[model samples]
Target chain A: MKDRSGSVLRLAQPVRLWVQRFTFLLLLATAAGLMLLGKADTVIVERIRVEMTDAVAPVLDALSRPIGVANDLIEHGRNVYGLALENRTLREENARLMQWQAVARQLEAENAVLRNLTGFVPETAATEVSARVIGASGGAYVRSVLVAAGARHGVRKGQAAVAGAGLAGRVTEVGDRSARVLLITDLNSRIPVVVESSRDQAILAGDNSDRPRLDYLRANARVSPGDRVVTSGIGGIFPPGIPVGVVVGTDGGLRVQPPIDWDRLEFLRLVDFGLGGPLRGQGGAGDPGGRP
Target chain B: MTPAGGTIAHRVDAAAREATPAVLTLVLILLDVVPLRLPEFAVITPSFALMSVYYWTMYRAELMPAPVVLALGVFQDIVGGGPLGVGAFVLLATHGAVLTQRRVLMRRPFAVGWVGFVGVALAAFTLTWVIMAVLHLALFNPLAAGMQYVMTVALYPPVAWLLLAVHRSWVQAR
Candidate 1:
């Protein structure tokens, strides 16, 4: 009996080792194959990505709520300490803004008259959908965020995501219940922008850096630090004249300092300008005509 | 000792104990993807999952096996929106390499284990950077990757200590 048991144990040990080795090799090979497949078959990989994201979006949305509350609590505490000082500043700013408000109203009335005289066809109005940010890029070389709203909520690819006073990013992928917003700071992001002060066209190209550089400006373009950059609407992906960023540095190596306070971003307003962007088949495919 | 329901309870407890390592690793992967909302935190979210993977792969290889690692890595890749299978490849390579060096790591002092972890993190980050550059066919700025590696390595002691405590109380006691 002892000899028989010993022989069985010896056989099982080698078999177990072989099984372990085989499993390891198989998993390694599978992982390598997936990398190649991701490159070769992007459509399927993207589908899987969005489906997985949709599955987890609810959990992420639930998880991020507490963090948002905590952030607000901290912000409130900071504001409380400066309440008196802030109130005075706000009061002064409000007075100043009231003057500007009258000017803006007068300009709008005059512009309407001018448009009527020219028989001009007005551009489509934009609608905004609010979404809460649930996931930021996970320390990879990517700059993106996942928001809780998706195609079901009228969020679509190439819609401009505005947050924290200016443009943040554009929707790159949309699922049934979640969407991924690729930030303007990602390496692959390129935006057609014009320097507002000089009206010189250039492309804002990101290199995985916070300050995306302005490239391909006309040779004689006058670009200086503090020049405002706005969407040029060349591709129709974004509407013209949206506030993008402020230029930094000279014409040689210009960069833009986006107004977004990245750390404090908890919500986004995705604006669809009824243009359907250039990627869509028709101009009005994404038309949600009236303002939200 | 008791019959029927007591025996079922005991079995359930046993199963939970067996699942502790993998469950903890999964939780860490989730933590890695969750936005912390800290200033500049996105660029250096420190590979919390990698730390857990390294710990379990080094000490409890059977519990954190290759298949489990692959599944967890894939989940991380999907959630993080990174290139598919990159996480799996990095983790599987780490698991394979650590298995060969287990004997040495097992007998060493904590400091030596940390040094070993630093070496592993270096290799892992470098491999990831190379794969990303190749996949994009463009040279990525290594500064963020380098920063993440520094933070990951710096953060190992506390994470390992937590895992060690869990292993001692739950896994080893059983």
Candidate 2:
């Protein structure tokens, strides 16, 4: 009986190894197949991605609060040392800003009169929803952030995510309680922008770099360093004249230096301009006009 | 204690033992996706989940099987917001490759295992870069990939030590 059992066990051992190997191969192939499926059927893939992100959004949200606080504390500690110098600089800037405020008010009054004379119809009222960034794409390939607000908070796809003093990115995916913002630095991101000074139209294209490059500029667009780039609003995805970045390099390749301090991007103000065009109401994966 | 109660406790303990590795791996994955908020930290975030997989697969292959690795990879991909299934493919390949080397790796010293992990991580990152490039139809800047590889290799010791401590205390206690 012992000999027979031993032989049986010996036979089962090889079979078990075969089963394990087969299972491993099957799973590996399944993973590869999923990648193809994700590319072929992006709508289904996006739905799954958003659901998965939404499920963990709360856990990530709770986990990130302490880290945010810790970072703030560190910044505060460093700021204490530079407080006096910062105060002087801020005071000077405040004085300058006060002068600018006066100019802005005058411009507003003059613009209103000009608009009334031209019978210009104003755009719809814009709305803002402030959201905390809960997660980020830690991998180098994707530059995106998961904000704590979602469709439930009136955060829709194609809304502009502004951080600090410039446009950060646009909303690509929105779940029940979480949304994903594709930053301007992502390789997949493209924005129609105009040179604020020259009014030359160009496409701001990202190559997974901190500084996105300008593409498709006219040969004699007269673009130079220190020129500002703003949304053209031609596509109607974003409102016109939103600050994007400034041209920092015009040699070899044009690079725009966005004002956003990405490291300190803890919060975002998602702005909705009530403009819907070619890129609206579709999964941003198949965006034809570089809407998001 | 009642005999039935003792049996229930035994089953619960066995279940917990089986779950420990997966739970630890999931936690590391969540850590991988958490926003570090440091300058350029996102681009070079180490593969913390890979360390967990390597540690468990090296020591306890039964608990850290290919299916579990695939599931964990999918979760990481969905949460990390990268191209879907890329993470799953890379991790599944890592598990298969490491399984064949398990015998040799097990017999070697900790430092040897660390060296093995360097090769595994390099191969994994290269695979990811290639797959991403293909999907995007453009070559990604290899600078970020190189930085991530270095960061993952530099971070292995502490993560491996932590996994080892967990293995010794909770996994092997019974």
Candidate 3:
């Protein structure tokens, strides 16, 4: 009986080891299989992700307030140190600006007279909401920012988000107290844009890079480096004439140096342009005859 | 042995064994998500999570099971915005590689084991690059990927030490 028991014990050891190893391998196989199969329908996943992001945006915003304050304090100290020289420069610029302001008033009077003669009326500006950027979705992929204001603050999906400088991107996902703004640098982002100097239309395409590329530019388009780019309002997604970026010439094509510094994004403005209105039939607000 | 004492000992041994693998899996997941940016070495970003997976497989294969490692890889895939099985395949192969050389690695000193880890990480990263290239039909930029690998490799030593400390504490406490 003792000899038989010893042999059985030795056999059981290997059996147990094999079972453990097999079980582990099986689990890994299942996880991989699930990931591949589960991610097949990204549209549904993206919807859910947007909703979740909106829900958490406000909480993140509250938490980030202290960091924002600290940054502002440091910036203020640096600005104060250079205030004297800056004031001197600003005084000269102010005098130059006053001279230009008088010329601008005269041009505006002349332009209004021309508009009256042409029966043209300017569209009223839309309501605006100011929001603070609370968190950043920093990773190898997915360039998104979370802002404090959301549905409660009249922030809606597809609203044009901007910073102090110019157009940032559109709000793709919104929540009750927060929202996620997809930056123009994301691979999936595309915008209808026009060259400010030449009036040539082109599509701005993001390829997960800091500077986005301008596609479909006409061969004879008179675009040059340092020319400003602005939204053309072709798709009705964004309002017309929002400053987008400056054109930079690349080896292969033209790139846009976005007006908003994506890396150091802190605050954003969501223009409540009342896009869900009779603006579709009215054509683009900025266009003279409401024609494409 | 008395029946009551034997049962208690058996229960304690099973519980201890179960806890080891669970703890290691949690550590691996945590390392995968925490963003550690080093601006000085612009080209190379190290992945600490990959190192953890490699070390645990070599040191305590029984505790760091293949399946958990695979699951971790899949989670990384979803988070990294790539095809789901990419991380899974890379991690599965890495664990398998370590398993094949388990006996030799177990007896080696820390430095030899770390060097072995670097080799394993390089292989895993290369495999992932190939898979991505095939899927996208574009040549994966070696410089961009190499920078990430360098960062991940640089981060391995401190993370490995931290994992070791945690394991020791858990084992002693148990």
Candidate 4:
């Protein structure tokens, strides 16, 4: 009986090994198959991704706080170290800004007069919801940040998120109390941008880099280095004239150097232009030639 | 205590013992997303989950099976916002490759295992780049993946040390 049982066990060992090998290969195949399915970017896969993010968010939030506090402390130390030099620079800048404020008021009056003459309708002021950033990405695959405010705080999808410097990103995914801001440097992001100085339109396309490239410029589109890039509002996804970045690099491969200090991000302001998009309802195309 | 209650308690303890690999893998995955607020920690950090999966499977192949590794990989991808199934393919491939060479690896010294991990890291990163590049139909910048692979390799020793401690404390004797 013992000899028979030993032979049975010996036979079972090979079967177990075979099963293990089969399962491993099967999993690999499943993974490849799932990758193919994900290519379509269907609603189900997106929902799953969002749900997964939501599930993992709290644990990550708790884990990230201590690190964030340490980061803030280091930044504070740096600021204190540079306080003297920074204060003098700020004082000079403030004085210069005051003079510019006077000029701006004068220009405003002249612009209002011209607007009255031309019967121009100014854009409505944008409403905003301020929120703290909960998560910032460090991977090249996706450039995004998660904000604590979501639908609960009036943070809607497709709204522009801005930092102190310039346009940060757009709200792409929103849960109950959190939303993901796909930064302008993400490979998938394409912001309809215009050179604020020349008004030459182009698309700002991110290629998983710190600087994004410009696309779709007209022939002889007189572009030069250091020109400002702003949203064109052609797609109606973003409002016009939102400061994006500045053109940088040499003649051939010009890129927009965004004003974002990628090292430090704490809070963002989400601007919800009530109309949301041009296709949504109001046809405010900014067409001066249309019948008024 | 009654004998039946004692037996039930003993079974629960045994079950918890069995779940250590899965639990640790899950925690490592949670750590995967904990954004370190350093500029250098930018976008691609070390693969803590991968290290743990590889270590646990190498040491206790029966306990850390292919299904568990596959599940952990999928869970990590889901949470990490990685390309779906990419984790599974890479991890399962790693598991299969290691399992085949387990006899040779188990006989080797600590230095050999560490050296072996470098090759594994390379394969994992290369596979990731290929999968993503093919999926996107564009060439991905290898710089990030290369950095990630280096970090993963750098981080392995400490992570392996911790896992060894856990194994010694909880898993080795019984």
lDDT string for model 1 (B47-141, tens) is 98889889998888878888999988888888887778999899889888889898998888989989999999999999999988998787887
Scored against the true structure, residue B104 in model 2 reaches a CA lDDT of: 93
Number of clashes found in candidate 2: 0
Give one clash count per candidate, in the order shown: 0, 0, 10, 2
- B34-89: candidate 2 lDDT, tens digit per residue: 88788889789898988888888988988998999999999998899888799999
TM-score of chain B of 4: 0.92
lDDT tens readout by residue for model 1, A7-84: 664788666777778888999999989888865645677788899999989888888888888888988999999999
Interface Cα RMSD in Å, per prediction: 1.2, 0.9, 5.4, 2.0
Model 2 lDDT tens row, A122-202: 998989999999998887799999999998999998899999899999998999999999999889888999999999999
Q: Identify the runs in model 1 with alpha carbons over 4 angstroms from their true place.
A: A1-19, A250-252, A277-292, B1-11
DockQ-derived CAPRI band for the predicted complex in model 2: medium
lDDT of 4 by residue, A1-292 (tens): 0233346648887666666667777888888888876665556776777776776677767777888899889989999999999999999999999999999999999999999999998787788988876666555575777777767778777789999879988887777677778888877788899998889999998887888889998888888889999999886788798999999975657899999876566788999876543232111123343321
Superposition error at A98 for model 4 (Å):
1.9
Write the residue-wise lDDT of candidate 3 on B1-174 in tens digits.
112455777777656755665556544543333222223221233555577678778876666677677766755554333455767777788888888887887897888888888888889889877866664455645766776787677778888887788667664344
State model 1's lDDT: 0.85
The docking quality of candidate 1, as DockQ, is 0.67
Number of the top lDDT candidate: 2
Tens digits of per-residue lDDT for model 3 on A1-292? 0223346648886666677667757766775565445445444544554565564444455556665677678778989999999999999999999999999999999999999999996766798899887655433344556677888889887788888788887786666777767778765578899999899999998765678889999999999999999999887877789999999999968999987656456778998777673232221012343533
**Candidates 1 and 3 compared by DockQ, better number:** 1
Ordered from best to worst lDDT, the candidate numbers read: 2, 1, 4, 3
Residue A60, candidate 3: C-alpha displacement in angstroms: 6.2
Compared with the true structure, all predictions reach lDDT values of: 0.85, 0.88, 0.69, 0.78
Displacement of the residue A71 alpha carbon in candidate 1, Å:
1.7
